[model samples]
Target chain A: MKNMYEILINALQADELIAQVTILNGSNVGEKLLLWPDGRKYGGLGSEKLEKQIIEKAKELFQRQETRKLEFELDEGRISIFIQVYPPSPRMIVVGAVHIAVPLTELGKTMGFRTIVVDARSAFATRERFPHVDEIIVKWPSEALEALHPDEGTYVAILSHDAKFDIPALQVPVQSKAKYVGVLASKHTYSILHEALRENGVSEALLGKVHTPIGIKKLGSRGPEGIAFSVMAEMIAEMRGVEIT
Target chain B: MRDVMENISNWREEGKQIVLATVVKAYGSALRPIGSKMAISSAGDISGSVSGGCVESAVYEEAQSVLANSEPRLVEYGIADETAWSVGLTCGGTIEVFLELLD
Candidate 1:
């Protein structure tokens, strides 16, 4: 009987992704679910009935490499397994590589988001400034984002603070289902641009998802670091949906 | 247990015979948040996770076994829970655990 931890460490070391499902809260506090890409499965939390149900759920999230917290008590709370699915690390795509992008990229990586900084100007997106970035693309936002296969887990932050660069990056996520979409600008300017999105046929629902006045709160941030931190904070809120206290 | 790798490694440096447990699969919804892990030593010391607190006491027993026998084993919890009031997998999901002795 190979311990679940060893099996997973092997998988991760081999670059083979495996999802480990556990009971975080409620009943069945420590039930286990082992999911594989090849559809091979193992273990049971509590009941055969519940195990089958969780497997079905795990399969769905496994494909997306999504980590989710769920609550269930249909069996009258007998088996409440809060499944936290751990797949692979999610990737983040930044459309602009500028002065602020350098620090932002490094901080993003520290937070575990795979960062890619892109810019049409090679001088700005140089590897020297953004060493932590997994990839540096000297291309337009549309081209770079599309090439990255922007998905629901993808986070695209428009840090150029320029209409030309910001608009294209914003539009890409609007067209695809990028998880987090943010534009660096003031609230007033964002509202005007947001209105334009609706007029341009982008749905109101999607437009609402954009984080304008980017970042959490500009306590006293006036320089590039402040802007970068603000943007990163807002992005963190959007990704985790963490509410302000 | 990527998150707990540092702690496990620290214990390993101390020459602790560590036993690890991880949830490899999940069905419906389970508890303790999947991908959770727990590392235990033959000296009865432990860290990390596999589930919430409810099953830690139970899983520890198995982990201690690993430290003693130096072999891995698969353990199950909840089992399609029956009593809604008990501390079981309320999500109605199932999970499989793969336990290993980290030498």
Candidate 2:
């Protein structure tokens, strides 16, 4: 009984991946069709043929995770539909609740990411320290990542400077489908960590994906807040598909 | 859409008629990306924005007409448009906005 707008709002609120197709041109202007990833559809554009065409186009857009406007030529006339895909919001998973994690999480939240903080040190990963983070997990990085299941929409930051923690933390994200995995380490530390990860059986291809000495180059930024800024800049670049040499 | 959802829901709860305007296409350095949206209530209240304060007033006016007739419309703004120049996109971009009543 709910209207299409209410239904669309509910689906978005529930964090469900959905595609909304709006007829921008043609006799049925303003008509909409909602497509779920699981092949469920609602509403119509007045004709079975047009709906079928839109469903096919929606599937392709869903795969690309893109919003696009397409013009279709029919026997009657030209129909244009704006297809908008609503995916779950991206997440920022900080693997260490260090000083940088504070501003990093803050920046993540400001950038509309679901920020999470993880640390094995209970003393470090406290609500008092991360009062605004969406979630704080006081567990080893590997375990936390395993439970969280980092997906292609997740950006992982390994700020556990110590190798004992860093090595284990690096292992999980490097093998998972996380979109970005950045580590805060100096050149010397990165080389050492690189060897250790290789010893742990991480493939060269996967290890190559890890962003070392993390953050934008030549930033000249120093200290916790500065480093966090650079790291976030790099993450944004990655998220927006911008390449920075 | 997410950015304007809270205000849209609040306006809906107050029984205000609403129009949702979305930027369906942006060409040349548009300030807001495609799919950016703004919600306009019948009382002239607005939430979110589709441009960098360049065209909200114009879009708001169009939304009022849509609310009156319950007809959706597509509006375009560009620096080259003489009428749009009065409330043009200072960013020198062309944008096509789709306005529809939120039923």
Candidate 3:
């Protein structure tokens, strides 16, 4: 039991996704089963057959990153197990440290996201500008993203508004497995970017992934702060697999 | 669950028996989502919250019994009936919490 305690602490502190399964209702109530992200199993729920079923179920819920009480009918009887999943904070990569990125990163941190801001201009991407951001890279989007390696948990927002930065920033996430990639631009700017991306060999299918005019439509031209709010909200909706117009 | 790590560790090192109560399932709208946890020490020290203060008192009573007997229990609170008004969730949600002894 103490070993289980140690493992849970270490895994959470290290930001590893793991699940702790506790028998919520059964003769073996309070018995636990722990599962690692790599399919490794530790501890047990006291029955080999029951544990096998839970291992399979854990993987399913683990992917969705949800926690719930699951009831299963085993050879012994009906048992309810509480599956507690702990996933690391999702990564939010802001591709420009502009005025919007300031509030965007602040809101991102408040919402429990690991935020990074990348901009080639050191004057803009300074510690004083983004005090709460986890990382600030003063490299061009092309160079920064190459080392950043955006993955499925990453959410990238291109706010540079310049073709030099926006074009390559948009291109990088489209080629990666990032869940959400948004570009801040007006209709005229979006049209220009669309043509440039097409000329740069970004396929129509990949270009479709970019959310142009990035903030939620209901925001209605409020300014940088409100736009930042809308953009972060849209990013969250995308991360949760929600559909938005 | 992660925020109260230091408190949980200190409680265990002090040889205090502890009970962990976790929100396993929530129906309708809930303030806290499933997997929210609260740890109660034998001396009645609480480090976290399972609810947003709607039912911690009831859970604390339950934790005392769990620590005394080393037994685990699944408890449910909701506004299903007029008598349930004492512990009713104003948000009209039913939260099922699983309580267990943590040695």
Query: What TM-score does each of the candidates earn?
Result: 0.59, 0.90, 0.82
TM-score of 1: 0.59
Task: Evaluate every candidate with DockQ and list the scores.
Answer: 0.10, 0.81, 0.75
lDDT (tens digit, per residue) of candidate 2 on A1-245 = 77898899999877789999999977889988899989999988888998898888888889988899889988988877899998888899998899999999999988878899999999999999999998999998888999988898999999989999999889988999999999999999999999998998998999999998898877878889999999999999999899989
Instruction: List each model's interface RMSD.
Output: 8.7, 0.8, 1.0
Give candidate 3's whole-model lDDT. 0.86
Clashing pairs in 3: none
Candidate 2 vs candidate 3: the lDDT winner is 2
Name the DockQ score for candidate 1.
0.10
Identify the superior model by lDDT, candidate 1 or candidate 2: 2
Scanning candidate 1 chain A in windows of ten residues, the lowest lDDT window is A78-87
Per-residue alpha-carbon lDDT of candidate 2 for residues B51-82, written as tens digits (9 for 90 to 100): 98898888998888999999999989998876
Question: Predicted chain A of model 1: TM-score relative to the true chain A?
Answer: 0.68
Cα TM-score of candidate 2: 0.90
- Residue-wise C-alpha lDDT for candidate 3, range A144-245, written one tens digit per residue: 987988898899999998987888778788889998989988899999989988998889998898887897887674788899899999998997788897
Query: Candidate 2 — which pairs collide?
Result: none
